[model samples]
Target: MIRIVIVDDHPVVRDGLRGMFDGDDRFTVLGEAGDGREALAVTEAVTPDVILMDLRMPVLDGVSTIRELRSRGSSARVLVLTTYDTDSDVLPAIKAGATGYLLKDTPREDLFRAVLAAHRGESVLSPAVAGRLMGQLRSPAKEPLSHREIEVLTLIARGCTNRETAGRLFISEATVKTHLLHAYAKLGVRDRASAVATAIEQGLIRRD
Candidate 1:
């Protein structure tokens, strides 16, 4: 079973998610928090395998909370559940280390699947977000990217094969593909095009 903490400012939302998870055999909601600071404290106290985080809590908000947790070396995989759909809101959460982004309206089963995937370090982003992010990465930057990621995205944008990005980056093709997946998750995009666009927008990589 996957142990999880649910953090949202709404008691109703928390109750609903708890009810849903309580009915599942593979997951159990272990704790609940209505604010970001409480979420952090509860998570640190219990150290669950996953956190279902709401975006707009009063004290810290979802993005900063995730960043704080990650900065403090907490390994709980964060899966964001919020009503926000804009790229600006979602992308910041992703960049702050959320493993997934989901609308509050997500079906219970699908939300469960996303949570499970996040426990395994996979991400969930809407297709439209994926597109806009890639489109945005086609700009200039200041943040540092791994040499390997640079090689991969540059090649990907140029239409290089995964095998080709791998060859040029001097890593296994599988490794190149894996890095792209992480990059995409971190960039809050889905494919190479969106990854490139969002990376540029987020300063994870460069542009002319």
Candidate 2:
């Protein structure tokens, strides 16, 4: 079973998640924490297989907690479950070593899938969160993505919001996030600025 630990300031959120994962043959909710410092303490004590982290919390907050986890070389992958999927939220979590990111509103099934994927060593993002990440796969020489990811990239280059991109591309924001996460892995880039700069250098988008 996938051993999981949850870290969120809200007790209800933690309880709900625990109930969600309880007794699943594929996963086990080992423990949980209500703040950053506690998260560290519990994580060190139990060495959970994965952490379901909330970005906004009192005390250490999710970003700093993730940094500490990395600094200590904890192999536990973090899956950031937050209410905000904005650029501000998405960028820092990845920068701080979170393996996956999604809004708290994520459907329970997708949340479970994301956790499982992260445990398997895959980076996952909500589509609204992935557009900026996908922008970096701009390469002239490399084989371009099929029609969909390209649409996501173009909208990213144009600074369109994920909602706008979704509207334009006839897809959901989550779909956009998945595309960008795929692109991020392929391009070896993280976050918007690096992704965009790399794309420009690769001639995937016009410098003008």
Flag clash pairs in model 2. Answer: 126-177, 127-176, 127-177, 136-195
lDDT of each: 0.84, 0.84
lDDT of 2 at 46: 93
Error of 2 at 125 (Å): 0.5
Question: Which segments of model 2 are wrong by more than 4 Å?
Answer: 135-208
| Candidate 1 wrong stretches, greater than 4 Å | 135-208
TM-score of 1: 0.64
Write down the TM-score of every candidate.
0.64, 0.64
Error of model 2, residue 35, in angstroms: 0.6
How many Å off is the CA of 67 in candidate 2? 0.4
> For residue 61, what is the lDDT in candidate 2?
95
